[model samples]
Target chain A: MDVRFSPEQQALRDSAAQAVDRLGPHTVRDLEDTERAAKLDAAVEASGWRELRAAGEGRAPLASAVEAAIIAEEMGRGLADAPFVGATLAAELRRLVGAPPATARETVGFVADLSAPAVADRGTLPAGAVAIDARHSASALVLVPVEGGHAVAEVSLDASIPAEVDLTRPAATIAAGAGMERLGPVEQPLTADDLRRWTALGLGLTSADLVGVMRGVLSVACEYAGARRQYGVAIGSFQAVQHMLADACVAMEGSRSVALHAAWAVDALAAEEALAATAMAKAYCSRAARMVCETGIQVHGGIGNTWDCMAHVYLRRALLAIDVLGGAGANLQRVLDHNGIGGADGLR
Target chain B: MDFGDSPEEADFRRRLRDWLRDNNPGLPASSTSDAYWAGQAPWHQALYDAGFFGMSWPKDIGGQGLPSVYEVIVDAELARAGAPPRPSLGYLVVGIGHHASDDVKQRFLPGLVNGRDRWCQGFSEPDAGSDLASLRTRAELDGDEYVITGHKVWTSYSDAADWCLLLARTDPDVPKHRGLSAFAVPMRQPGIEQRPLKMINGVTREFGEVLFDGARVPAANMIGQPGEGWRLAMTVVSHEREPGELGYVARYSKVVSELGRQVKADPGKFGPEQVRDLGWAMIEAEMLRLHVSRRLSDRMDGISHGPEGSVDKLLMTAVEQAVGHAALSVGGTPHGDGDDMWLKVYLYSRAQSVMGGTSQIQRNLVASRILGLPAS
Candidate 1:
């Protein structure tokens, strides 16, 4: 068995990294700047990053989960204020159930599960929200539970929703009586297998994002440790600081390894196997990403605690990311349930 | 990028699995027992006769000379079948086979391959556990022989070994690292004494300490030139840490599956926290498995071992300890005879962090060597 990426894939990843680098660092001010968000969205779409999973002349939809993960990781590393994750998930759903394509320039948001579908059925919907890059999203593709499986629904998010802890990606809570359009499953409805595949893709991509976040934060902390000297030597020369940064590196690499495996499995393995692998990847990466970010802050000393530093940016994003599909406990429960060791009570 | 076995590897694995099924020797009562060693001797011989022993060794040294992947398959299959571990002498043979003189290789490789001779390492002394270069073992050349005198502790299987890869100080005036030398000394001498050191488990005598008042060995038994012990010892330690030889992934997979079986057999025995802990252990084991597999793949692709081996070693310790803890937590209170297995595993797992370089040393290695952090 081999685990090294091909030279071509490496080249693709390098280009993605370059694109994210060109966007510059994401700060708190940029989170609230609509003009900067629009510019970033235009740049992302112009780079064809949004269409990575869309089918072309000779390619299938989402040709390589590994390539998609590479792009997602770069976006996460740059902390780009764009809806790439949701857009890609929407593209995947369209490919799976034959839904209409999203507009060329319009960003799409995604929700894997709709917690309060009853609010949607009622004429007046409460402020129902899901965490996505909703600042510029035109519509949201959400999965609602049906009798046997799940159905896809598109909801317009023209109504405003306040930002959450992760200011970069705002939660667009839908207002009452907003336009809601049901899509997909019109011909062949999604089955249990489709839901499993969707969950696998979601977990794989999210884990990749966590890997990127951890790596980015760790890189920053390591650089700071080397340059921020005290007592006539770099603090990195001290075992206390060196050990913390080293642990962060290990956690990031471990998350990357498992996330890459899960991403590959999403495309290569069967439904059950892919789901199990994704569960494992998410379970490990969720906690690892948090530890890496927390340690990154600690390594930076007092300056790391300030909002201006990028450490909080990474930590905030990681905290929000881990809760997107589920937390570590929930994913771990999925693993146990898949293994037939426990009931599926905690799995969403 | 792929984790599945190739066609040839798949076939080899299938054949090995069949052979094991037909000739399965269940787990021995105790690894330190004479019967266990007696059983392992023939088992290793059978493996050698079947062309599975020296798959990665050079052809000039009476080996199959195959790629390292075949050896990995053999190891994986052995673990999957719960077969006895390979003889400890095999490790020394691999090291000496590669770095020793032609005379040394010819004299030792055959006996080691056939299980006629058992070997143990004498690198760690009571005062030189982690700082092996500071070992006080002395070997002075007198005429055509070298007289060795020192004490070695935590030497596994020394009681059953016929020979030892001993390290000693040859030049006291030089630096700690440069003055050392390595030798292949016969263990059946009057000056050498081995006393079994019972481990924390209270039932195993697999480890012991060896004392040498004044043991004599021919000068020709030196594996390399004088003052080359440090380099040779590094080689031996690297070989010890190499992936795929121990089939650790398959072994961990077995442990995790057994834990899952126990949990499933009685779901009410554990609380939600314990169940979650069990699931986390399974994930950790899988992560360790994948990490090691990636290392093995890199080796097959011609990438040599580096600081990444330390990463795998650290993960190995973590997963082993996690699994042991989970098993104990789920087993709850032990009822005398029924909980012996869990108690033994829990006690043994404590050593995972201590043995083969402590977890602290591993972190230091990764920090300085792999991460490029300045040494502290």
Candidate 2:
């Protein structure tokens, strides 16, 4: 079977790369440039990439999950401090239950350690709920108990507090018992199958972003190795440095390959199969990203700990990406559940 | 991009599955046993007879003249059916077909591919294991033949081999990398000695050390130019090193699933941590499968195999060890269970990191050749 990207996918990737290069942050200071951040947000909005999963003919997605993942990866590579992942997940939720798109910007709310979608009972959210990457959003979607299963609802966003660990994105908390209004009803309610498919999409995107993080950090480390010389030789000439970079490169490629396969499986396989693939991809990427990112920092020597170097930027973005949907441990647990280990029904 | 078999490929796969089921050979479980080693040749011949072996070679070489994907299907199905792993003689095929003259191919390939003439590699000597360029095997040209004198170790299947696709230094004055030549020497000829070594797993007849004293070879057997030996050896090594070429993903997948079955059979026997370790092993296996699928896709798109195979080798070692460790902690005892064979797998897994090429050498190759890092 052919795994090479089609010409159209290649064209999309090229355009995404071009956009990131133009509007992406170049220095650590660029993260503080509100003017550049606004422009980046506008460019992403104008591109309509966030709505790629919006309903189309026959209630299908406008584009494939692979296309959405391509955009996410490019955003991650540039460390573009924009509102893509949140806005995109918000669109995915609307499309899942056949709800019309909200007039204002929106993202999905998360509960339970900020890993899964927040669930509301009778249009009321529990305390400690937060909306991730809700920088410019006006509302956030939360799931509500329905007749057959669940339905989508939205609660207004006041403002985002600065996220502590991950500097790239902003997170906002919803007060306990915050009111959420149900979206206008359609013929179908969301089922467990629907949520599983949505989780697959979320996991696939995060895995892609983690792959991008590895790629970006490894590039930074390699350049540093080639330039930073000691005792009249580039550090890259040292076997110790070369081997570290090489190991990172290998792990990064493995993550990319598995992530691509998971993205493809979203449209090609059944919902359960897609979820399993995404969980495995997420596990692989999550485990590799931290070690690979550390290798980048290690190669940079002392400057890596300071705010000036870009290695911290990559690592920060990666930690957030790793936590989205699930980290390495959570994803491995998902795999175990899917395989029926420790499950009530026992083996398949 | 798609990763499923085409209609024709699906059909070939179905046929092979049926064949394996109908012609299953019940061999002894212990690979160290004489009965098991005796069973290997017959299995190889049966696969050849059924057109499941060498499906990728040209028609003139007694192959089906199919794409390499067919061979991949055969490998996967063999693993799925609990048969022996696919024979790894693609190296020998690559060494002879790519560098040898037409007459050489016509003389050796037909028999080699069909299991009529078994061959082993005589490349790694005592001092040349990882640093193959430093080999001291010598071959001096006479009127119509070359007289070879050298010692080669770690030659797999040398005892059963009808010929040894040997590498020797034909010009000592030139640089080591430039002075070498390859020969398809007769294994049973005079001045040749084969001493099969017992591996740590207690497997005999699978590997050997050979000594040569003026072993004569026809001058026509010299493959390519005098200095092309290094290139040919690299080519040969890459064939087996690639996960795509060897279908290593399918082999690992089979083992991982088997381990899963064992854990499921008696979940109480394993701790939660052990089960999670099994899950980790499962994902690692899947990672290799995905990586190999992408590499195969690249190969189908006409990208040639090269130094990147070192990446595949490294990943394979990691995955295999992960699976082996899972097997040991979850199901294996100090002594292996006959039905499960967990400890046997664990022991063999350690050998993989060192065989064919050591993991250190693979990283060195990747660093220097792929990453443009300076070599010491």
Candidate 3:
């Protein structure tokens, strides 16, 4: 019944936190714009993070979920241009698709076909199968081969990468070569359990980052409020400022808890359990982060809105996080679908 | 992490279901009003007399003393049986039976458990809903008694309540939150007035407002130390909401299944995404139920309810609201019994996020307490 992070897990989170702190958000931002899509190989190789990616194949999915969460949080906090999309997501997918060759590095794709390709069997092929565009050289078109392609894995564009505000981790449109040809039929679409695991991993990382961003925003707001005077007294002394800061504090904590719970669920429970918790975490924390950080900018008033102000960084990151991993609405729909609740009125 | 209830719980649920099926005095369908508060007091008392109410309260306090989860079980059964809700604030908020002082507990608890008296909370005011500490309702000491004067709003069933577990400010200047006290004031006492407050469903008055123009009550009526009103109120507020998305999930599942049938019956009645929406909500229900059950279990084992409660509140509210809207969408013109149910749920569901705590407050709780983030 009790849920507390194991000392080892706590250590893992702390380590990630420390690393991000040392690297700092500015350094990460710098790296993002300069390196963009090319940073993935270098980032993975330099941080010894490649080992973490490799470990997922042999480790428990829960353990991988936890580690991913920790790393994501750190990266999010630092706003680091690390390849979370390629490394974390690809790692999990590889595990689900079963172990791949050591030389293989997996990346997912979503094809948008304006013209519905005439298939030999419309009844047999799954609805959402589009071609995989190559952002990375190693990227490939993935098919879970179900009902002989009549029904298949639900796929969408992985926006966490190239669409990232930080250009370093920009999602590259990779070309699919031999990997594109290796398609198989999926008997079961990505299960609720699998989505839960991936989602837990996504939420944990995102929440941690959101918390970090909020912390940065709050620090800046507090400083300005203390130094900025109104009616000859520090603005920080004002009740309005205090209340705003307090609210931000609350939001930051909420995001943190969601991330922690999501991580814990992924590690301790089945994938479906993890998915639900993660979805809750993602939905709540993202909205909270936006509110808290926006307030941070508001408290700073004119100063916070400047391009140079770090508050905007937090704001941008929050926006990116919401869309990166499918957004709150999408995850919620996933939850509903998994439970066998269909028809327009069923959810009500 | 294990969200499923124990086998014993399953068996107990089954027994409860079977018993209700055999013995439930089913209410006439037309009699089930939105403000359906119409059971005989003695009939309500009979359950506690037979040891059915307060299953988790201490045995010394006239309960079965089972695990807290059993209370959830009992609530589920009661709702399923469509039995009238027993007057609860007296037992749930005030101590059941002899838990309060011998005289106080004995006088009020038995009456409440046995349904002779109904209780309503007297906490919120004009300025205090989510920000409850700002309430200006005052009660000054008058020798061995306290004279209370203030207005209370959003008191559920206050008009019908025989007693109120009320909070009043005893000192105005010390601090905004401190110097407040809680008293169990008899609603029928002098200088007390109650008026009904309409809910979204205009047909029902499930709540009311109470005004006290110098209402006086004995000093012994206080629940705890004089200045401990904040703590007492805090404890009670946290307990007001809990897990049971299972019922909502079940209800939503029924909606989705029925929709599939309806749509299949009439192709033009539902859109394509409408069917998906129902399915998605059902999936989410299962997911939310699992997470919420795990959280409840964690809390029952003495762990902090943590930010997980906020997460559950947020998800549950979204599901309830979404399901409500979905039902309305599918029901088309909002007519007939289905539309009526849809409208009632849609209106009530709005409170899911705001009632226990606002979604905004929940987000703040998560951000500050759980994450090591600075207060923004």
DockQ each = 0.57, 0.57, 0.09
Query: Which candidate has the highest DockQ of all?
Result: 2
- For model 2, the docking class works out as medium
Error of 3 at A197 (Å): 7.6
Q: Which CAPRI quality tier does the interface of model 1 achieve?
A: medium
Residue B193 lDDT (model 1): 97
Q: What is the TM-score of chain A in candidate 3?
A: 0.72
- List A-chain TM-scores for all predictions: 0.88, 0.96, 0.72
Model 3 regions more than 4 Å off: A1-4, A24-67, A97-164, A173-325, A328-348, B1-35, B39-59, B62-117, B123-153, B168-180, B188-194, B203-205, B210-219, B226-341, B344-376
lDDT of 2 by residue, B1-376 (tens): 7666889989999998999898867564333244656677777789889888877778899878876656657766876786765666777887788898898899998898888888889999999988899999999989999999999999988898889988999989988898889988998999999998987666777789999998999988887777789989989888768776665665677777777887778877777778877888999988887787788667666678788989888888888889888877675666443543667667767977888698877887887788776655
Extract clashing residue pairs from model 1: A2-B1
lDDT of each: 0.73, 0.83, 0.57
> Using alpha carbons, what is the TM-score of model 1?
0.91
Candidate 3 docks at the CAPRI level of incorrect
Please provide TM-scores, in order, for all candidate models, with all chains considered together. 0.91, 0.95, 0.66
* Order of models, best lDDT first: 2, 1, 3
lDDT of 1 by residue, A115-188 (tens): 11222333333344553656566566655556666566676766446655665666665534656666743544
TM-score: which candidate is best?
2
Distance from true location, Cα of A345 in model 3, Å: 15
